[model samples]
Target chain A: MASSPQLGFTTASGLEQDLAKLIVDSLRLEVAPGDIDPAAPLFGDGLGLDSIDMLEIALAVSKRYAVELRSENRAALASLRALAAHIAQQRTS
Target chain B: MMRSTDSQMAPVPTARRAFAPVAAPAYPLVAHDSPGCTLAWRRDRMHSVEEFLRSVWGLAAQLPPKRYAINVCKDRYLFAVGFAAALVARHISLLPTCRAEEPLRRLAERYSDAYVLTDHDLDTSMPSFHVTDHARHSSGSMKIPFIPADRIAAIAFTSGSSGFPQAHAKSWGSLVLGAKALGRQFALSSSPPRTAVGTVPAQHMYGLETTIMLPLQWGWSLHAGNSILPADIRTDLERLGSPAWLMTTPFHLKAYLSERTALPGLEGIVSATMPLTRSAAQEAEHIWQVPVHEIYGCTEGGMLASRRTADGDAWTLCHELRMRQESGGTWVKGGHVGAWLQLTDRITLRNRREFLLLGPNYDLVKVAGKRASLAALNAALLRVRGVSDGTFYWPDQGRSGNGRLSAFVVAPGVSRAAILADLRRFIPVYFVTALPRNATGKLPHEQLETFAEQVRHSGQARTIHECRRESFETEARRGFSQGARRDE
Candidate 1:
C-alpha cells in the first residue's frame, strides 16, 4: 500500500493510510488520503468534520472492518492513528 | 341575575384585587410536579429538578447584561440550562439554524447586543460566555422563577431566500402551550415518565419541541448527549436507567434498522424532520418492538399533528389546535399557534381534527400528464431493491437548459441502468457514494443544485443507454428492435 509520511514524523502506517482513504471516501472530503496527517485530529479543528460525518464514518468502518466504533469509546476517533490502533486491537481480540 | 349583581357589588377590596388581572400572567419555569424528579441526564448522572433550577439561577446570575443570548450549546442538558437561564435573566434566546461563520456573522449584524452562550470555545467575533464554566452548584433557595406569559422567550431563525436569517419570535405562553399540546398528543401522562433521547439537535424547532420541551413539560428526563450513530445511540440508551423515548428523524431510523442496532429500554420512537416511508416505519416497529410515531410541523410553528405510522396515514391534530381550509391552503390556529398560520404544505382536511398531508406545495411535479410529488418519487427510489439512499432532482429548465428530471443514488453493486429500469423511466442517473444531506438529514435545494452542477461537470452522470444496452439487445433478440420502451 502507498503510505505518505508527514514532515518531521515517521511514515504513515498501512492501516493509517487505509483509514485516511476510508474517511475521505466515506465523508467525500476533497482532500486526498496521502495529504491527511495521521496524527491530526479527525474531527472539529483538524479535519473540520461534523457529527453527520462521524455517523457516516462509523457506518463505513463497521461495514468494512466489522469493528464497531461507539461514541462511548471516543478515543478511537481522536486521530487516524488511534482509529487504526483501535481497529487492530478489536480484530485481534 | 339580581343575586349575581349583588355578589359583584359586595366584593371587598381584597376580592376585587383577586378579580383584577395582573400586569401579565406568570408561568412557572419548570412544569414538573416534584423537586426530586429527574430533569436531565448528563452522561450517566441524572440531575433532579431542584438541582436544575439551582443551576439555572446560578447561570442567570453569571450571564452578562445582554438583550439576546445566541444559544449554541451542543449538550442538550446544558442547552436547557442556558435556555432557562436566559429566560430568568429576562433575555431572549436567539436560535440560529446553524453555527457556521456566515450565519453567525449575519446574526451578529442583526442583533448587535447579542452574545453567544456556548459549552466550549467557538470561533466567533461576538462576545461569548462559556456555559460549562459557569455551571455552579449554588446553595441558594430552589425557587422556580415565574416568567410573564407575554414575554418574548426566544427568537428562532430560518434561512430566508436572500440568505438572511428570518426570525420567528415566540412568547413564553405560546411555547408552554405548544409543549403542553405536544405532551398531550402522545398521551405521555398515561404511562410512567420516560427519558427523551434524541438524535436531532436541540436547536432545530422539531428537536426543541420534542426533546427539550416535551420532557420538561411532562416531568421526563432529557438525555444530554446528541448521539446519531447507531452504535452510539445504543450505548447511550443502554446507560439510561429509565425507559426512554427516542426523538429522531427518518434518516437516523433507517440507519439503525439497517444495522439492526440494539436499542434497549426504548418505549417509543418519534420521527420527524422529513417524511418517513411506511415500509421503513413498519420495519422499525417490527424490529424494535416500539410504536413509531411521526410528527408533522415546520420551523414557523411547533408540532401541530402526529400519527403512529403503523396505525394509519391521517394525522390527528393536537387537541388544542384547530385547522381550516381557506383559499386552497390549510391554516392552523388556536392553542399554541395564536395567529392563523397558513401552512406551506398542500393538505387535505379529513375533518375538523385530522388531515392527510399531500407533501409541500412546491414539491408538486407533473410529468406526462400525471401529478406526483418529488417526495413520493424519492420514496419510490428508496423502495427499489439494493438502493441504499437516493433523491430525485428536478433541475430548473431556465438555468440548466435541461428541464429533464435526474436522480442521484447511493447503491453499491447496483448499476445505473438497473436503477433507471427499476424506476421505469429513462433519465440521467448518477451513482454517488453519498448524498450531501445536512446534519438534520435534510437535502437543501441550494445544496442539491450545487451537487447536480458538480456531477454534470465531473462526467459522473450517465444516461441509461450509455450505462447498458443489454435490455435493448435482449429486445432485439426477441425481434423487437424499437429500442427499450418505458412501461410508463
Candidate 2:
C-alpha cells in the first residue's frame, strides 16, 4: 500500500503523507498522492468531490487509520491537514 | 355600446376555470385577492409577500431607473424581491447563470447601463444595489402592477454555440402562461398551497420557474435557504414544516438521498435541470414517501412537460401545449411558449401528449447541476492561449459522485499547468495530454503518468485551492460549520 511513497505523499510530514496516500490509493484519482495538497480543503469546492466521495474516503480512513469519522466532525473533515491532525490525536493504530 | 378600451381598462380577471391560462402582460403579476401574503423563507425566517412587495416597490424607487437590471441575490427571497422590483420599475431582469465577476462584467458590458443587484456587497464594476439598501416603503395598500403580456420580462443566459452565452428572451405573458401550465401539471390550484424548497438556484431558468415563479404566480410560497450539504436540504424542508414540495435537479436529488435524512412530510417532489435516473427517482419515492415528478424543460422554454420519473421515461406535455416533429426535430407550439419551438432533444411521439426522450440532438453536459455545452466548453478550451487542440469529457453515467471533468489536449510544449489553468477559467477541470512526438496524434493511456508529472512541475499553475475562489468557499465553509454546529 505504501509502495510509491517516493513522490507526493512520501515528501509530506508523516501523518498527512499516510492519509494522502490512503486517499489517493482508495479513491483511485488520476493525480499523484503529493497532488492532494495537505492544507487543501477536503470537502466541496477545491476537491470537486461530493459528499458521496467523502463517504468513500471516511470508510477508507476508518479502516486504514483505525478511527471513526463522523460526518458532522467539521474539523476532522475540514481539510487534509486538519484531518491528519485529528487522526494523529485519535488514531488507535 | 361598449368600448374595446373598457376591456383593457378592467383587470383581466384570472381565469375562473379550475385550471386557467395566464396572459403575460395582460394581468397583475400578483393578483389582488390572491390571499396568501407568505413570500418565502430566508433560512429559518418566513417573509410575507406583502413585505416582499414593499421591498420591491421600495428598491424600485431608489434605482437610477434603467431598462434592465441584473439580479444575483443568493437568497431566494431577495431574488424574488429583485425580480418583482425589476418588473415594477419596468426593467427587464438580466438573469445570468453565474454571478462570477467575469460573466456579470460581460453582461454589464452588453447591457451597458444595467446595474447589479445582490444581497452580498461583492465588488462589481456595474452600478450596484444591495437588498438592504432600500429607502422606507409600505407593504400595506400595495397594488400589483399589471404587466403587458408581450413585454420582455427577463433574458436567461445559457451557453450556446461560439463559446459565448446565448440569451433566451422571455416575456411576462409566456412566463405567466408557463406558470399556469406548471400549476395545472402539478395540480397546484386544487391542493393546498405548498411551500417549495429548491436545491437549484432561483436565477437559473428551471429554478426561476419552478421554485420562484411558479409559487409566486400560482399563489404558493418558497423556502429561501440556499444549498448546503444534503442533510441541510432535509433541515430546510423540515424547518418549513409540512405540505412542502422539493424543486431540485437530478444532481441535488441524488445528494440529498445519500443523506437519508427524513423530512417531516412532503406533498411531492419536482425535479428539473438535468435528467433524473429512474433508480434515483424510485429511491426518493420509496424513502421520502413522495411522488417524484420531473419537469422536462430548457432555458429557451420554461417548464413544458413532466412525468413520474419512477414510472419510466414517458413525459406528458403540459395540457395546453402540443408537439409535432419536423425534419427529425420535435417542435412545441401554443400556451406560454408563445411560438413554435424546436427541442434540443429528439422525441418519439407516443400520442398527442406523451413521448420518450430519444436523446439529445446536440451534446449538452450537466455536471453538478450545471448544464454547459460540450462544444462550447471545448471551443473555450481550444481558445486558450496555449492550446493547440482540446476536448472535454465528463462521466456519461448520472453523476458518479466523483464529479471531476477531464480534458484531453494535443498541445506540444504548452505546459499542462498552463492548459489546466486556462481551462479552469471555463470549467473546473483535470486533463491528460496526448502530445505524441507529433502534435496531432492518436491518444493513449500509457503516457498519462509521465504527462501528469510534467504538467505538475511545469509553469506556475495553481491547484483549485490556490485561487481566490477558495477563500470565498472557505468563508462559506466556516458559515456552514457554524450552522451545522447549531443544528447539532
Candidate 3:
C-alpha cells in the first residue's frame, strides 16, 4: 500500500500555495491545499495523481498563469514547489 | 500463372518433412527501403531510418534475457526503438495503458519473467533496463533483422468487464498488415511520407497503430514528444519540415477548438478513443482546412473502420475487412483482425461496406479513452470493506463528452477519500441508506434514476449541470436512453 502524503507542515505560501489550490480545484481533490506537502511528488505515490490528472493540471495551470506546461519537461511536475519554480522561471523568461 | 513452391519443398526428405510444421514466412523489420528517410523527430532534430535501425540493433544486443518486456518509454522515438529491440531479441512487449504501481504489479505478477524497459528511472520493484542509455549506441551491426511473421510481437491489455486485465496478443504479421490497411484506408500509402504528431501516448493500441506502426511501416517520422498543450502542438507543427497528421482524441480536439489553437502544416487529423461529436469535427475541419476522420475500433482489433465525421455518420470499413450482424450483435473479421470478434458497441449495418454505430453497449462506459463497465466498477466498489450496497450511475449520455460517473454507497463509517483510493478515481460518492434494488436484486432503470435524483436533491451533492434536469426529462420520455442498461 502507498503511504499518505505528509500534511500540515510549514504553511505553503506564495505561488506554491496558489498552484496547490489550483490543482485541488481543477481535479476536485478531497484534500485541502495547505495540507498538501509542497515538496512531495505530485504523481505516483505522493498524491496518487494519474495521467488524466496531469492533463487537468496542465490545463488549469495554462488557464490561470498563461504558462504552457509542456509535458516534455517532466521535472516541472515533480512537486508543487517544482511547478511553482517552473512557472516563476517561465514568467521571468 | 499460378506459382507454387511444391517442387522445391519435395526435395527435403519427404517422410520426415511431411510431418514437420511448415516454417512461417519472414519479413524485414523495417518495411521502407530508403535508409536516409526520416524515422523520428526528437524535438527539432530529425533522426533517419539508419539511426533508428542502429538504435534497435544496439538496444537488442544489450537487452537482458527476458521473455517479456514491459515497455514504459515516455518518448515515442525511444518507445519505438525499445519495442523493435524487444521484437528483434525474441521477446514480447507487454503494453499496459496504466502506469500506476497497482497495474504494474498485476502485470509483473502475471508475466513472471517480465522486466521494465523505461527511459526514466522508474520506482519499480521489477528488474529494469534504461533504454535511453543505449538508444544512441551505434557499435552493433545495423542490419535490419527479418522477423518471422508468426512471432508474437506485443501483448496489449484492457480492463475487462470482469475487472481483471485481459491480454490481446498480436503477431508480427497482424501488426504489419493492420498498419498497411490503416494506411490504405487513409490513402497514406500512396501519399508522400508525412510526420505523425500524436497527442496520445504510444502505449495505447490506437496510438500504437497510428503513431508507431503507421510511421514505421509507411516510412514517416514520429514526433518524440507527447505534448497535448496547444502552444506545444503549434510549436511542434511549425518545426516539422513535412506535413503532419495529428493523432488525437475528442478531449484534446475540444480543448484545441476552445482555445482556437492554430495548427499549421497539418495534412489531416485522425481522432479515436471516443466518439467525436460531428459539430466538433466539422468545426475542426473548417478551421484547420483539413479533413477530420474518426476511427471506430477496440484494442482487440486495431483500426476496423473509419469515417470522415464532418461528412457523415456512416463508417467505411477498412480494405479486406467484413462485418455482419449475427444473433443481435456485430461481428467483424478479415484483414489484420484474424478472427471474428464481437464488438461492444450496438451497431446498425448500413450495407456491406459501411455501418452506423449506435453507441457503446449499455454496460460499457468510456471516459477519456479509458473504458470500464459499470458492472466492473460496482464489483470493485462492493469489494471495499465496510461497504454494504452500492451502484454506479451513468446519468446522461449526451454529457459523456465531459461526463463524471456518480456512485451511491451504503457505507456509514467509510470515508469518501478511502473509497476513492480503492477505486483509484475521483468520483462523486453519495452516501445512501440503501440501494433501491428490485426483489430480484437488480437495479431497474427508472427506479435508480428516481432514487439518484432524490438523493442528489436532499444531499450536499452539487449539481454538475443545470441542463441535467432537462436531459433526465428527455431520457425519461424516450422510455429508454441509448446508454441505459436493460439487465442491470
Candidate 4:
C-alpha cells in the first residue's frame, strides 16, 4: 500500500520532506514545499501536473531516489506521501 | 514486415485464405462471406460472415438513398457494417474528426442530403440511425454489392490548421488496396486470426483503415468497440480470446502504460495519430511485454510507413509505396497515394527501406497529436473579446504531459479563468499566462515563465494584459524574434 502524503502523516519524515522539495524543484513549481499538501493529488486539481510533468517527475525520481520509476507503478505517484514511500521502498541509494 | 517481435499477432500459420477473383469485370468491394472465415468478434463469440453481411444489408435497406452518409458508429463492429452497407447501397461514407452534432449537421447540410450513422445515444433529431437495431436482421442470402473501382468509397475530412476541415476523396480502389498494403505491414493479411482493439474513434482515417476496412477486406476480427481504460481494454482483449492486437494512439498508449492494472498479454500495439516518444514506446514494451509499432501517416496520405519504435527511429516504408526526399519534404507515390504527395515531415533517407522522422515541417507546430499553425492560433487569440491588442506566443515552459499548447495572453480586465474558458471553446490550450508587453509593443516569450511563476505564487492570477510600448507594430515585430515560433 502507498503511504499517505500529509503534513503530520508519517511523522513528517526527512526523506518525505526531501522528496517534496525534489518534486517542487524538478517541476519548477512555485509553491513552497510545506505549502503543497503532501496528501494532495499530484496530478489533476491539486498541484495540477499533467502527463508531461509526470514524465519529468519520473526522471527526477530516477536520478534523486536512485529508483526506477516504471510506468506501471502509478500508485507510487498518488501523492507526495506515496512518492516518498515509493522512493524509500524502491530506492537504491 | 521489418521484424516479427510480436507474440500474439504472430504469423503462426493457419490455413492460407486466398481472395479469388470475381467472375464479372465489376468487383464487389466487400464480400458477403470471405471464403470460410469469421467476420468479427462480439460478446466473446465469432460473428460469421453471413451474419455480418445480413447486418450490412439490413442497415443498407434503412438508409435513405443518397450520395453520402456520415459514418460515426462508435462501435468498431457496427462501423464496419455501416461502412460496407454504405458501399453496398452505392452511398459514399463521409467521415469527420468529431462526432459532435454541429459538425455533423454542417457536413450533412453541405452534402445536401445525408444522415448521421452512429451507435452513440445522441440528443440531436437529425435524420440518423442508431445502428444497433440492425444486428438481429436475418441473412436472406449471400448477395454481394459490386462497386466500380472509380467510385468514391469514403470522403475523409482533415481538421484544418486555420479554417474549415478539408475533404480528401478516396476511391474504393485506393482505400481497399491501401488497406491490403497496411494488412501486410500489420501481418493482418495472412491467417492465424488476430482480433484488433483500437482506442481511436472510427471517423478518423487511421481508425477507418485499421478497424473497419482491414476487418472487412482481410480475414481479421475486430473487438467490436473502442477501449479506453486499462481494465476495460484487458476485459475486451480477454473476451477476444488471445493473439489480440491493439490499434491505438500514443495519447491512449501512454495513459494505458501508466495504469497499475495488469494488462493482458497481446500480440502487438500499432500506434498512430501522433508520434510515439521513444521513452513512452520503450515503457509500453517493458510493461505490456510486446512490440510497439508506430505508424507515420497523415489523413491526406493515409497509411505510409511504420516503425517498430523500440527497435529504432527509422521507419520502413509500406511495401506498395515508393518514396524520395526532395526539397525539404519526402515525396511519395504509389500504393494508390492518388498523386505524388509530399509529406510535411522532414525525413533523412537512410537506405531504400528506411528513414528517420526529424520533426514536423518548418511551418507546423504540433502539440500532443493536434497540429495547428501558430499564425492561426495567434489570429484567433486577437479576435477574442476584451482584448485591445494581444499576442499568443509559444513559451518554452508550461506544457504538461498532455501536450496542451502553452500561450501568453495580454488581455486587460480579463481573468486567466475567462481567457482560458473562452479560448478553450475556440482552440485547446494548456497553460495561459497574462503578461504585459514591453515598451516596444512586443511580448517577451522568455518572461512567460516568470509570469506563470508569479501566477502560481499568487493563489489567484487576475493579472491584466498591460503594455509599456507606445509604438505597437514595430516592437511587436522586434519582440517576436524566435525563428522557430515565426509564422512561416
Q: Pick the DockQ winner.
A: 1
| Alpha-carbon runs more than 4 Å astray in model 2 | A1-30, A40-93, B1-25, B31-36, B139-141, B360-362, B366-371, B378-488
lDDT of 1 by residue, A35-80 (tens): 9988899886788776767777888888877888888778988988
Against the unseen true structure, what C-alpha lDDT does each candidate score? 0.78, 0.69, 0.80, 0.66
Task: Give the TM-scores of the predictions, in the order they appear.
Answer: 0.72, 0.72, 0.80, 0.66
State the lDDT of candidate 2 residue by residue for B292-333, as single tens digits.
999888788888799998998899999989899988789998
Residue-by-residue lDDT tens digits, candidate 3, B1-488: 11112111224676788676787666566665677888888887988888888899889988999899999998999999999999988899999887767778889999999999998877789999998889997675566677777889999977766567779999987888898888888888425778999988888899999999999888788899887878789999999989999999987888788777899999899999877889999999999999899998888999999999999999999977999998888999998998899987778998999999875334656432345767777877877777888878877642443446788888888654445444433356677788899998877767877887898889557332322444456556666433412111
A best-first ranking of the candidates according to their lDDT comes to 3, 1, 2, 4
Best candidate per lDDT, number? 3
How good is the docking of model 3, by CAPRI class?
A: acceptable
For candidate 2, the chain B TM-score comes to 0.76
Candidate 3 accuracy as lDDT = 0.80
Q: In model 4, which runs have C-alpha deviations exceeding 4 angstroms?
A: A1-93, B1-36, B360-404, B407-422, B425-488
Worst 10 residues of 1 chain B by lDDT: B1-10
Error of 4 at B452 (Å): 12
lDDT of 3 at B293: 91
Chain B of candidate 1 achieves a TM-score of 0.72
